[model samples]
Target chain A: MKEYLKRIYAMLIYLFLYAPILILIVFSFNASKSRGVWSGFTLHWYSELLKDRQILSALYNTILIAVLSALIATLIGTAAAIGIHNMKKLKKKVIMNLTYLPVVSPDIVTGLSLMILFVFVKLQLGFLSLLLAHITFNIPYVILSVLPKLKQLDKHLYEAALDLGATPLEAYRKVILPEIMPGVVTGMLLAFTLSLDDFVISFFTTGSGVSTLSITVYSMARRGINPKINAISTILFVTVLLLLIIVNIRMSGNHNKKER
Target chain B: MKSKWLSFPYLVWMLIFIFIPLLLVLYFSLTIRTPDGLVFSFDNFRRFFEPIYLKVFLRSVYLALISTVICLALGYPMAMILAGNNFKRKNVMVFLFVVPMWMNFLLRTYAWMTLLERQGLLNTFLTFLGLPPLNLLYTQEAVVLGMVYNFLPFMVLPIYSVLRKIDRQLIEAAADLGADQMTIFRRVIFPLSLPGVMSGITMVFMPAVTTFVISRLLGGGQFTLIGNLIEQQFLFVGDWHFGSAISMVMMVIILLSMGVLSRYDKEHEGGGLW
Candidate 1:
C-alpha cells in the first residue's frame, strides 16, 4: 500500500510537470484559433508558421546569436580556465569570484546593469549589444565547466611532451587539448543551450528591430490569443527535446568510456 | 602550464563588461545629475524606501518565499522516491523532469495562462464533471502556481543528486542499530540532504523573487513585483537613478541570503549552472 501511494504521488508530480506541455502540443494542431476550445485537427498552424516573417526572423536571430556566442565563449573561457588554474591562490580566488558575479547575481540585475553600461558608453543596442551580453553571460558557464577538467588532467604529461623535444604549442595541442576536449565540448553545448533559452537578459539588451524567439513569444503572448505562437512553440519544443537527447547520449557515452 | 597571460583577454573582458557595468550601477544608484554636473546623493535609495515601493519589495519576497516552500514540500519527496532503490528507470525519470525545463520558459508559463483562464481547459473539464468553475487565472494563487511549475525542477534536481550519493552502508547501519524508519530518516537522511536543500532553496527563491514574467502573465499586469517595478522604471518610465537603486537593493538582498545559504552548503556539491 505504501509503495503504491508513492508511485501515485510520483505520477501526479510528473503530470503537473507535463500536462501543460502536452496541452500545448495538442492545441497547436487544433483548427480553431481559440486555445480553450478544440476544433477538428489540422496542420494549418504549422503551415502558417513557416510563412510568419517576424517569427522566422526571430528564429534566425536566436540561432545566429547562440552559435556565435557559444563558440567565442568556449574559446576564451577554455584559455582563461587554464590560466586561472595556474595562478597564485589569491589572484585566482579574486578572478573566480568575479567570474561568479554574473552567475550568482539575479538576471534582472545583470541585464539592467549591462543595459546601463551600454547606454553610458553610447553603444548601439541591437545585434552587437545582444551578442555581447550573451557572450558575457556565457563565458562564466564555460569556465566553470572547463576548470574541472583542467584540474583532472595529468600534470606531468605536458612536461613529458616538452622534454621529448616537442615545442610548447605542439605539446599543448598534442597533450592538453585532447585531454580537456570533453570539458570544452560540454561547456560549448551548455553555452549554446543557455544562449538559446535566455529570455530576461535578451529582453533587456536588445533594441528595436532585433529580437530573439523568446522575446517574440513574450510579445505575442502579451498581445493575446495567437495560434501562430503555439505552432512555433511546438517546433521549438521538439527541436530542444531532440538536442537534449543527443547531448544526453553523448555525455553518457563519455562516462562509459571513462569507466572502462 | 604557468602561462597566466592566456587569461589576459578574459580579464580585460571582465573588467570592461562585468566589473565596470556593476560599478556603473552603483554609481547611478548613488548620484543625481545637477545642471552643472553629477553629484553623489542618497535620494534614489531614499525614494525606494517610500511605502509604495517598499510594499512591492515585501510582496516579492513574500510570494517568492511561499513558492520556494511549496517547491521544497513537493520536490523533497519526489527526489527521495527517485533516489530510492526500489525505483527503476531513474535516469528516464530524471530526464523527464529536465525536458520541460529545456522548453522555452516563456511558452511554458504561457501554457498555464491558457489552462487557468476562466473558460479554459481546466474549467471546461470541471464543468464536464458537474463541478463549479474556479476563478483561478489572474490571481495571486495563479502567480504562485506558475512560479512553482517553473522552478520545481530546480529544487528536485539538486536534492536528487544529493540523495543518490548517500551511502547505503549508513542507512543499513542505522537499521542495525534498531532505529525505526522515521528515526533513521530524521536522524540520518534529512541532515545529509540539507546541503542540496539549501542550494535548491537559493536557486528557486532567487529566480522567483526576481521574476516579472510569471507575475505579469498570471498575476495580471495590475500586479507589480519588485522585478516588474524595476522593469517599468527602466523600459517605460525612463528613470535610471531609481531603477539602479532598486537593482542595487535587490543585489544586496540576494548576495546576503546566498552568503547565509552557503554556510549550509560547505561542500559546494551541485553548484554547476545545470
Candidate 2:
C-alpha cells in the first residue's frame, strides 16, 4: 500500500511536469484551425511556420542579437577569466564575486537599471543598447563557465611553449586556447541561447525598430491568444530540441574522446 | 606596470559600466523627480510606504514564498527519486528536466495560456467530459503555477546534486536497525539535503519576486507584482524616481532574505548561503 501510494505520487508529479509540453508537441500537428481538440494530424503548422514573416523576421533579429552579444561577451569574458585566473596577488576572489553580481542579480533590476541609464544618457534606444546590455550580463555567464576550466589547466604546457621561445600570445593561441576551447564553446552556446530566448531584459532594452523572437511571442500571445503563436512555439520547440540533441551528442563524443 | 596595462581595459570597462551605473541608481533613488529636473527628497521612498504600494510589495513576497514552498515540496521527492533510483533512463530524465528550461519562457507561458484560457484546451476537454469549464488564466493561481513550472528545475538540480553526494550506507544502516521508512527519511535524508533545499529556495524566491514577464503575461496585467510595478513606473508612467524607490525596496527585501537564509544556513550547516 505504501509503495502504491509513493508510485502514484511520483506519477502525478511526472505528469504535472510533462503534460503541458506533451500536449503542445502533439497539437502542433492538429489539422483544424481549432487548438481546442485534437484533430487529424498534419504538417500544416510546420509549413505555415516556414512562411511566417513575423516569426522569421523575429528569428533573424534574435539570431543577429545573440550572435553579436555572444561574440562580444565571449571575448571580454574569456579575457577577464584568463586575466583573473593568472592574477596571483590582490583580492582576485573579491573581483570574481563582483563579476558574478550581474549573474545573481535579478533580471528585473538589471533591465530597469539599464532602461533608466539609457534614458539618462540620451542614447538612442535600439540594437546598440540591447547589444550592450546582453554583453554586460552575458560576460558573467561566460566567466562562470570558463573560469573553472582555466584554473584547472595544465600550466606546464604554457611554460614549455615559452621555454621553446614562443611569445605569450603564441603560447595562448596554441596551448591555452585549444585546452579551454570546450568551455569557450559551451559558454558561447549558453550565451547565445540565453540572449535568444530572453524576454524580460530584452523587452525593456529593445527599442522600436528591434523585436526579438521572445518579444514578438510576448506581443502576439498578449493580443488575444493566436494559433500562429502556437505554430511559432512548435517551431521553436523543434529547433531547440534539435540543437540540444546535437550538443548532447557532441559533448558526449568529446567526453569519450577525452577518456581515450 | 605590465600587469596594470593588461588589467587597465577591464578596470575601465567595469568602472564605466558597473560601478558608475550602480552609483547613479543609488543617487537617483534618494532624489525626487520634479518638472524642473530633480530635487533631493525622500518623497519617492515615502510614497513606497503607501498602503497600495505596500500591499503590492507584500503580495509579491507572498507569491514568491508560496512558489518556493511548492517547488520544494514537489522537487524534493522528484530529486530523491532521481538520485536514489537505479534507472536506465536517468540521463534522459535529467535532460528532460533541464532542456525545457532553455526553451523561451515567453513561449512556455504562452503555451500555458493556450492550455488554460476559457475557450482553450482545458475548457474544451472539460466540456467534452460533461463538466463545467473552469477558467484558470489571469489568476493568482496561474501566476504561481507559471513560476513553479519555470523554477522547478532550478530547485530539482541543486537538490539532486546534493542528494547524489549523500552516502547510501547510512540509510541502509538505519533500515537495518529497524527504523521505518518515514523515520529514516526524516532523520537521515531530510537533514542531509537541507543545504540544497536552502539554496534552491534562494534561487527560486529571488527570481519569483522580481519576475515581471511571468506575472505580466500569465496574470494578464490584472495583478501587479513588485516587478510589474517597477516596470510600469519606468516604461509606462516614465517615473524613474518612484521606480527606483520600488526597485530599492525590492533590493532590500532580497538582501534581507539572503541575510536570513545565510544566518539560518550558518546555524545549520556551518557555511553561509553562497
Candidate 3:
C-alpha cells in the first residue's frame, strides 16, 4: 500500500509538471487559433511558422550566439581553470570568488551591470555585445566544471611526461588535456544550453534590430494569444527533447565505461 | 606543469567584463550625473527605501518564500520516493524531472498562462466536471504557481542527489537498534539530508525572488517584482541610478542569504542545476 501510494504521488507530480507542455504540443495541431477550444487537427500553425521572418531570424541569432559563446568560453575557461589550479591559495581564492559572482548573483543584476558596462564603454548594443555577454556569463560555468576535473588529475603525470624529454607544452598537451576533456565538454554543453535559453540578459544587451527566440516569444506571448508561438514552442520542445536523449544516452554510456 | 600564464586571457576578460561592470554598477548606485559633473550621493538608495518600492520588494520576498516552501513540500516527497532503493528506473524518473527544466523557461511559464487564464484548459475541464470556474489567472496565486512550477526541479534534483548518496546502513543500524520507522527517519535520515535541503532552498528562493517573467505573464502585468523594477529602470524608465541602487541592494540580500545558507551546507556536493 505504501509503495502504491508513492507511485500514485509520483504520477500526479509528473502530470503537474508535464501537463502545461502537453497542452502546448496538442494545441499546436489545433485548427482553431483559440487556446480554449480545439476545433480540429491541422498543421496550419506549423506551416505558418515556416514563413515567420522575425522568428526565423531570432532562431538564427540564438543558435549562432550559443555556438560561438560556448566555444570561446570553453577555450578561455579551460585555460583559466588550469592556471587557477596552479595558483597560490590566496590568489586562487580571490579569482574563484570572482568567478562565483555571476553564478550566485541574480540574473537581473548581471544583465543590468553588463548593460551599464556596455553603455559606459560606448560599445554598440548589437550582436557583438550580446555575444560578449553570453561569453562572459558562460566562462564561469566552464571554469567551475573544468576545475573539478583538474583537481582529480594525477599530478605526477605531467611531470612524468616532462621527465621523458617532452617540452612543457607537449607534456600538457599529451597528458593534462585528455584528462580534463570530460569537464571541458560538460562546460561547453552547459554554456551552449544556457546561451540558447537566455532571455533577460539578451533582452538588455541586444539593441533594437537584434533579438533571440526567447525574446521573440516573450514579446509575442505578452501581446496575447498567437498559435504561431505554439508551433514554435512545439518545435523547440522536440528539438531539446531529442538533444537531451542523445546526450543522456552518451553520458550513461561513458559512465559505464568509467566503471569498467 | 605550473604554467600560470595560460589564465591571463581569462583574467583580462574578467577584468574588462565582470569586475569593471560590477564597479560601474556600484558607481552608478552611489553617484548622480549633473550638468557640471558627477556627484556622489545616497539619494538613489534613499529613494528605494520609499514605501512604494519597499512594498514591491516585500511582495517579491513574500511570493518567493511561499513558492520555495511549496516546492520544498511537494519536491521532498518526490525526491524521497525517487531516492528509495525499492524504486525501479530511478534514472528515467530523474531524467523526466530534468527534461522540462531544459526547455525554454518562457514557454514553460507561458504554458501556465494558457491553463490558468479564463476560458483556458483548466477552467474548461472544471466546467465539464460541473465545478465552478476558478478565478485563478491574473492573481498572486497564479504567479506563485508559475514560480513553483519553474523552480520545483531545482529543489528536487539537489535533494534527490543527496538522498541517493545517503548510506542505507545507517538507517538499517537504527532499525536494528529498535528505532521505529518514523524515529529512524527523524534521527538518521533528516539530519543527513539537511545540506541538500539548505542548498535547495537557496537555489529555489534565489530565482523565485528575482523572476520578472513568471509574474508578468501570470499576474497580467499588474504585479511588479524586484526583477521587473530593475528591468523597467534600464529598459523603459531610463533610470540607471535608481536601477543600479536596486540591483546593488538585491545583490547584497542574495549574497547574505547564500552566506547564511552555506553555513548549514557543510559538504558542498555540487548543488547547481546539473
Give the best candidate by lDDT. Answer: 1
Question: Model 3: per-residue lDDT, tens digit, A95-138?
Answer: 99989988888888888788899989889899999999999999
Q: After superposition, how far is residue B36 of candidate 2 from its true place, in Å?
A: 4.6
TM-score ranking from best to worst?
Answer: 1, 3, 2
Across B1-274, the per-residue lDDT of candidate 2 in tens digits comes to 1132444456566666666666677778899856897899889899998999999989998999999999998999888877866566888878877877877777778778878888778899899999998969999999999999988888999899889988889999999999999999999988988878888999899999898877887899988999989888888898787888888777777777777877777876675334
Q: Each model's C-alpha lDDT?
A: 0.91, 0.81, 0.90
Order of candidate numbers by DockQ, starting with the best: 1, 3, 2
- Candidate 3 lDDT over B145-175, as tens digits, reads 9999999999999999989998888888999
RMSD of 2: 2.6
Per-residue lDDT, model 1, residue A101, is 90
Candidate 2 lDDT for residue A211: 81
Work out the TM-score per prediction.
Answer: 0.96, 0.93, 0.95
| Candidate 1 lDDT tens digits, B113-184 | 889988789998898899999998889999999999999999999999999999899999999999999999
Please give, as one word, the docking class of candidate 1: medium
lDDT of 1 at B133: 95
Q: Model 1 Cα displacement at B26 (Å)?
A: 0.4
Error of 2 at A118 (Å): 1.9
